[model samples]
Target: MHPINLNEPATTRPTLAESLSFTCQLGECRSELLPLLSEVSKVVSGEGSLSKTLKLVLELMQKHLQVTRAMISLYDASCDQIFIHESFGLTKDEIEKGVYYPGEGITGKVVETRQPIIVPVIADEPLFLNRTGSWDKTVDCRLSFICVPIMRGMKVMGTIGVERLYNNRQLLYLDLEVLAIIATTIAQAVELHLLERAHKQVLQAQSARLDKELKEKFKPANIIGNSKAMQSVYRMIDKVSHARTTVLILGESGVGKERVASAIHYNSSCGGGPFVKFNCASLPESVIESELFGHEKGAFTGAAARRAGRFEEADGGTIFLDEVGELSLSAQAKLLRVIQERCFERLGSNESIKVNVRILAATHCDLTAMVAKGTFREDLFYRLNVFPITIPPLRERGNDILILAEHFNAWFAKEQQADVPAISTPALNLMLNYDWPGNVRELENMMERAVLLAEEGVIHSYHLPAALQPAVLGELGEQSGLEARLSMMEYELIVEALARFQGNMSRAAAQLGLTRRMLGLRMAKYQLNYKDYRCGD
Candidate 1:
């Protein structure tokens, strides 16, 4: 008799007499076998847990088949061995000893050759190692054994074996056929379980990678400032990041208060949680309340669905309220309650919901001044003032402008897929002397524009906006004195000459019809550096 080929249907190979004989016995075992298959099917299709499904398979086999011992040994491809994964009618100690190398015994040989084996009598078959100690060699054990490979397509994943009394030999072939069918089902279930586990692992790895990237992007080191004022802000951030204190970031309109809030959230103890932000000034006064504390369905006109508020959404995380000073007095009252009690009701509902969200508020307006004018609540100001961090305006952060310029240069270069150009000394000097009223936001926009305008692989002063030109040029018309005006024009001529000649003093002086020594004296008087024009070289 040849081993059954699992790749084909189980019914294809048997002869008419063999088929009739198995069919008669199959009918006899139908009462018990039908329920066993039903239960195994439920297990395999439901949760698809491999261990639980294997355990159920073994338990049903022992109960319905009246086997002395039953075991399922799964193949470990890494070690090329079959280890007992689930077993019925065996002690824990005996199960621990049930391991076999390829072709070691009946069970191992079945797995190694992807075939089935049946021993009519265990005492007569030399290949039956009895590693599980189901039968004693000293006694006359009348046990018959059958083992079959659990095949997935052409590959054998494991083997299922059962031992029964010798008197049950009349239906041995029938039992083998049933076990083979069950083994095929087990193989498919195992394959599906493995595939699902691998897919979950891939998703988890991708999630972890995205989380790591977000954390790094918002880390304190990436905030882009080395000024003393920014150093103080960094220290404040470090001190309050792990705490649940309410942070109030004070700065000018374009000073990156939101970025500071994000840095605090992503570096805090609740970094893994969500960070929800709302611009209180951007929304209308009529709907700002509903936006912060979401309203119920049909609560107001066009309110079609129940929506979670930022506070509710940011539970166990952080919420940044930008332009907090713009909130109405009624909204301020509701916000004050959340800050003090950590609970608030929805806009149209009286049901109070509790949340554990960290508050990080930012505003360009002075809340204290607004409170004096009765536009803001005084009590709310004190509550939000627990930990105040003031970000310096760009004019006060000396030399940080150059650092930020380079950062923006590289960022926009990559964004536009262009090469980052070197900043000329004249351009750097103009940036340093300019009093940036729009702060970092304006500087970032200006750098992006400069990169777009740059054509010679270097950022010259001409690439900068006309607004960045010296205040002296704007002051010329107001200064009515002829001497002052003439001196200004002379200074301009010398600078323009030097710039036109790429800082070559001889060429500049010859072009301007002045000796090199006289041009050097004028350059000193105007505080102009000749080397700043060398980009033309």
Candidate 2:
């Protein structure tokens, strides 16, 4: 391929499409057409995107084909719809109304027949719809119109068109051949765009569907948390839901570590299969192997009947080994073999029984330290750590305590028909101050007790659990760490202080025991203004 000067008019250069046409007449175009194609070859060989390639095709056609107006409509292979993607002469309104179905118009006919259409007069062509409204009631009464089908093998994807200003016998066969070559260029560009759009749509649909299905199927009744940290864990569940990998759920005790493990398995590819749960800490060192790997008839002293092990039962699914750090030395070695080879033998059966399942292990104990102490297999740790999702505890995630408390409180109120009081300022203060060691699971328990004790809609200071409540019910406690709680509070104290002072700068500063400048910095950090709280401050 050689270069052609793009600045020259279209009639000067012979198009490659014109070379392939029977009607094209060649006089003096070979020299001009060859260099243009060479430049085209260089550009088309660079970035292989739909937009770039379409622009290239239009440039090629404009250089060689002495015709009026051109357009490329692409076929969305998946949707079976034709849409005009790019055009040079069509008005914006014309383009908006440019969608074509098979056999509907001249373009449609070419697409339907997988052949070219040569209408010397567009107005004379029977299939031409002339969309009068699209072009302000003015029909394209061109004397020479040519439409050719663009094909990917036998399937017609789109059509490219070229029309001469007037019907003339003087137009050479080489010109039509050049237009045909340009039409082929349009076809290649359409294919690339269609494929790219299809890939993006497929990925988007998969991601959305997976997220929706996970929330519906895997939500356990006992698990509770709407905090950002817990939502982060939920998003991880959505991401790894369909993946085939080892998942390690890490959290402190009473943090519903088992609940997180269940969500993972139920959302995974092995969701339809059995969920085999085993407490590694509860099983004795000698029997842990038989319990996990299963025993055949007479495999052990108490092997009264042929029993399938946890692994065998959980085949084609997930095996949740809770407290996995407590596995003894021998058990860790056997487990490592299962992780590496995915093959394990029953206690009595010498025949190797291969299990097809995802491994989900949970631990309240620190496995990192256990790996350092040589109590746990480092290889097993790495294998299961493919996706490690941690459930953050209550102490770090503030406000989640209130959200979960309100949820569980509502549940308990409905269950027992108790008239639970609204949370008092003092009780809320106590709640905000106390460090909940038990996390969301603990907050749920406290709410249950509060709902039971409260006599009214308010869960007052009296309704709070002993651990969370100050001894003096009526008064806010001095040693209750309310000062420290206010210091750590993000926005509530600043808002309340500003409200009490009626947003007067000096008064609000005096109320908060801060300089006006210090108060401003706090206001900036929280994005709060006293004017925001006031009807008219």
Candidate 3:
């Protein structure tokens, strides 16, 4: 296909149909139109995507028709302009320059009026703007431009246009008819493409919302405690979770020290990375070094293959050392080195392996005493204790015992596929009286036993273990007379229920299995004002 030389002097040229008639017969225009439309139909209805189908449609127009260039422009509501969506025989720079406002040029006029336009000679028509630089504007050019609005019903979507060399006005009108037919086919394909793009945007929005919900479920605030002591712990967790600080969690055994460490790790910036846990007291001193610092093959008597330690496994994440004070002095020195340099050499290998990790250590022992006695290194102790958080024992966490008991009861009942039973007043009194030496761990185990042993839908005092029976209650309870003990127990239960409900009388009565009148009478007998337990407003 030769390009029309726009720089040539104005001269007489044969019409397009006259040129074709010299090569072929006279009545062959319908035969040419039929095959071109059929090829365009096959390209439009193909299983290819919108972008691919549009590209082939433009290319087919240039190939089967005697046109120098073909293009499909689409209306962009975002910018309120018509821009060339796809084109053939035009460079990328030229295509970028093909933009027009509504009714600005021949293509824009077709879009605005929703009609086809034919320019018998481009140089003679001032509306045929050569904005794409496909031809020289300073010379007489015998090029014809035909543009048809791509429409759906009465609305115009955009325009499909072509540039050709034609001298006869009758042949230019015929070219306009061919462009109109192709524009109709393109309209259907463009409609489907818009629908698919809208559906994809909806799916992307839904996926983002679900991702946010899942992240909220694992946040530190989901630990489930409303006590003032626990609130302080939550504040500490929130502060440390945003940094790379080494944290030392101090708490008694069974006080959920590991749980606090887990909360910090999951809420941190590196929450997506691995979280590796190791128990320093679980292994013997002889193999503790090999376990903390990965050992190479044949490093020890029983060592068979190379292995990665918890520190190496926790690269770009966090490592939790439980009972950290139990680490041997030799292992402590190696841990101190890793904390200082962020690198460590495996046992039996001199090659140092670098790691990027945050350390979180927990211990129930007195690290200061151990450091003074030379059992634990002072340098290592200081490194691990940069940010210390102590979780209070369950006995010290006032009303949280009842909250935790209810949570564990519901959890275990779900696990066993049994109905959740209500803890009776007698059983509640026994729990509040006893001192939980084993902390939350002891309460959790007791609740599991109580839930399993409970008959019907109520957990009575007899359903609890022997340690929580009347004989044990007598030793921990008021030790006054029987009536006095009952009255004091009644007062304590009312106060706890009101505090838990934040002075909501209705909910407090529901939890205590009493009516509004009965709860009010009890509150009066104890001289308790519900307003005293009200928080905020």
* Sliding window of 10 residues with minimal summed lDDT for model 3: 1-10
Query: Could you tell me every candidate's TM-score relative to the true structure?
Result: 0.51, 0.47, 0.49
Best-fitting candidate, scored by lDDT: 1
Q: Write the per-residue lDDT of candidate 3 for residues 247-326, one digit (tens) a residue.
A: 99999999999899999999999999999999999989998888888999999888899998888899999999999998
Per-residue alpha-carbon lDDT of candidate 1 for residues 1-537, written as tens digits (9 for 90 to 100): 223443446555564346444544543443556677777777665542467678888878877777778888887665677888888888898888899998898888998888898777778888778787766865536777789998865667788998877454336666787788789778865543333333335434654664565453323855876666777888789889989899999999898999899999998999899999999988889988888889899889999999988899999999999999989899999999999999998867989999989999999998889999999999999999999999999999976787788889899989989877666555666787788989999999999999897754556665677677555544543466877657654765666567556799998887667899999998886667788778733
RMSD of each: 27.8, 25.5, 25.0
- The CA lDDT of each predicted structure is 0.78, 0.67, 0.76
lDDT of each residue in 1-537, candidate 2, tens digit only: 001222446587445444434233434334556555566566654544455566676666676654457777776657666677776667878777877777677777777777776665556556667542332224556556667777654557787776555444335334455556655555544544454366446535654564575566444444665555776787788788778878898998777788888877776777889988999999678988988888888887889987778888888988999989899878888898898888998888888888897888988878889899998888888987889988787776666566566677778888897543345443554676678888667777888887776653445554566676433332332335655334333344565456445577677676556899998887876555667545443
Q: How many Å off is the CA of 160 in candidate 3?
A: 83
How big is the positional error of residue 8 in model 2, measured in Å on the Cα after superposition? 99
